[model samples]
Target: MKLGIDRGSLVAWDPDGEEWVVVGEPWNHDLPAFLADGEEAVRKAERTFTNPERVSGRAPSGLPFTPASLRAFALWESHMINGAKGMVAAFGSPGVRRLVRGFEAVTGRVPPPLRPRANYYREPQFYMGNHRSVLPDEAEVAWPSFAQVLDFELELGVVIAREARDCTPAEGLAAIGGFVVMNDWTARDLQWDDTRRGTFGGVVKAKTFAGAMSAVVVTADEVLPRWRELTGRVLVNGEVWAQSSTASPLHDLGAAVAYAARGESVGPGEVLSSGTLPGCCGLEMRRFPRPGDEVRLELELGAGKPVTVTNTLGARPRRATQARHTEVARRK
Candidate 1:
């Protein structure tokens, strides 16, 4: 029989149902009952997260994870040095709670307060930073500038479940919290301007920025075929302009993880967002989010509630990069 969601009475209300239910974590705890022996070890706190079920009613119809979940895994892993399965053993038993208590007593922060709900945080944006470059999609937040090629990229984000340093690709998949739709806004004008001038890795300023990411998390909660087709749209003033999908993403989770691991250690809760699709930005269409204009970004996760984002474009938007290459070249 389906185990009535009993995460040690450590459960949250289904935002949709308003009924107390077990908050699904990244993992499907179908192991043995012994794993939950230390069920009492779990505590309640403010947090966010959900599976990919599109049943909408009261709560926001998206999967938002709490930072607390990551902390819990960290503490458990420390004790279970052997691996996480051992952690399940520790929790199922009664003494597990005492052990967690002792650990908490030493380090005073409460165990699992809940992960912070990240707001529009990413490495890219409508207006790229530093140069104040103009990204392809409509800019919700004004930046420096956008006079050149307006562009956007289609990318993917790896929602993480736990954090681990020096992890491998296999570990990355095992530790991922979940998968969420991500868009790294960009500033094409700034890129074009900077390209003719000098170095430009600072593109991050124009690319990932807070609130740039759409928080529609898709965990393994719902039944999904191998690849799900979804529509991505960036609109300005009620016009359906930019269009793309998760299928258009150039990089996948596994590749990004392997590449990331080559350089630095990975952590839990970190998102590896896909950059941007090929033709979904202004650079290709030659449009940008001007001030006073309303920008609506919506992702149609077919048969699922589309993830929508609407922000008013700021007038006198910020400039990303104002490089007078011709004047400088002429002067020299």
Candidate 2:
């Protein structure tokens, strides 16, 4: 069943009626609370919504939940390799330069011009994002003044159903509650700067702004049949920039979940993303978003309805100190 939040209440879609039926009140509990009860909770909710006292006048298309934490993984080998090469070229790190040359000499294959550290290829790499920064589709994303290059990453995300730790691949697969399309907005300039500084903190700053997600979360059971062959597209101002099948993911959902759950508990309402699909980001295409640009992402889950998310870029906000200085100068 599709789940969503509307008017601060938990609601489920009644496909036959084409409206959102309230099943639980937010004042009493949230989606996480229901999730803690697992499949039985979902079944009970489905039954309760069948004859609810109130139904939304229209279909619910709000965020399913604000994740407690959002962990995004680099599951596309191409994206990770190419991104590392681009970063090494842009930043010119001495150690990386020597490493790339040594790798090319030993392997007899032209290594990525700037081979990333060995750990990147040894296992999955992921970073935590600010969950509070997540926004629903159609929200206006602010273009931070600190950045010059804005880009969008099209991804597939899963919400955890229960707390998980030290889970095997099969167990991790079962931990997933639902799926959502994700548009991870990025500031390339800031990201590169942070990378160059060797701190990697810039990744957090670049990624934290306005991560857009689909309005409803489609249950995992509904998507499992066609999970490997799912297709996705990235559109900028209605123009398609990239399209690729998710079948090429280097680390599938099960592996990604297992990696995240290793020695650390991932709780309900937390989001885990299967990073950017191959050729699905502006960075790979060498094109970036401008002010007032609209980025739309769609993922075909074969569930009769594909998940889509859209966000429009707003003009960069003026720095508070600069705005105050300008006001004082104008007054004088």
Candidate 3:
């Protein structure tokens, strides 16, 4: 849990191992995973992400994998529900090592995870539908060819604490795993085009680039007041472009998840984001991410003051020369 790689590092221990090992769940588990060493249990798992082919084959007609699905998976992982492969209930949660354990302690079973880590999830464990902001694939030092109007979100995301089959707002908050910061970057002009047409896919196009919803992510171990007294700020090019607090959320994490689960299932690793807090680029009237711009999102985690993540938007490398060099390197 030391701050070697990211926040409180998470690891999985086995029967024969002498110690714990670093690991990430199925999706965005990069921060700590980079440092996990030894222990094949987590290490081997570290590379089992779903591939493009698998992702394509698994897309169901109704589109499962949303807050409700995540909650359901959490129960099974915690041993709260029936544990059976192929059953949605048996899914696992992914994140840094500590997050999994913290969640298991509350839920009783280890939720399923994609492990070690893969690209920002091409298919979320749960469906976001149309109710939230866009969480991207990664952030950039410069906006690439496909990227435009880059922006960051200051958010608090959580996993379900207990089984929330059909819960209300109050009941939902009580079942939280804890909160972590999230930044949902956006492609403004692209998003605007999609929004006007009422298209789901285009709205998601905002999520296609380096989508690491974080400049940084912290667990309660690193945050303050556990889950309250939270405030936030966004720095753009060394200036305070936006500022907010936990109270700025349209709804707390639990509320968002609960709403996501009303007719659905909420499970572990089913990311329930606060969408975009006030002041982020997506909500701005005229300002948004520009090339070479540095963006930062800062917030309070448990016990820690405030951690900030700074990102720079840069242009994509030219394909003619750079792409040829990369191709040559691959051949060699």
Q: Please tell me which model should have the higher TM-score, number 1 or number 2.
A: 2
Pitting candidate 1 against candidate 3, the one with the higher TM-score is: 1
| lDDT (0 to 1) per candidate | 0.39, 0.74, 0.41
Over 1-332, each residue of candidate 1 has an lDDT whose tens digit, in order, gives: 01112432223334344444444342342211111321221221113324454222232222233222110011111211221222222212456546655666898643442211122122111121221221222235554354322223334444454554556656645555444444444444444334335365325434433234343444422212332355577767898777765553333344445555555565554555544443454444434555466666676533335555455545443454444331211100
Model 1 / residue 257 / CA error / Å? 1.4
lDDT of 2 by residue, 11-69 (tens): 77767666667776532547666655666776776676666455563455667777889
TM-score list, all predictions: 0.52, 0.82, 0.51
- Best-to-worst order by lDDT is 2, 3, 1
Task: Output the TM-score of candidate 2.
Answer: 0.82
| lDDT: worst 10-residue window of model 2 | 323-332
Order of all candidates by TM-score, from best down to worst?
Answer: 2, 1, 3
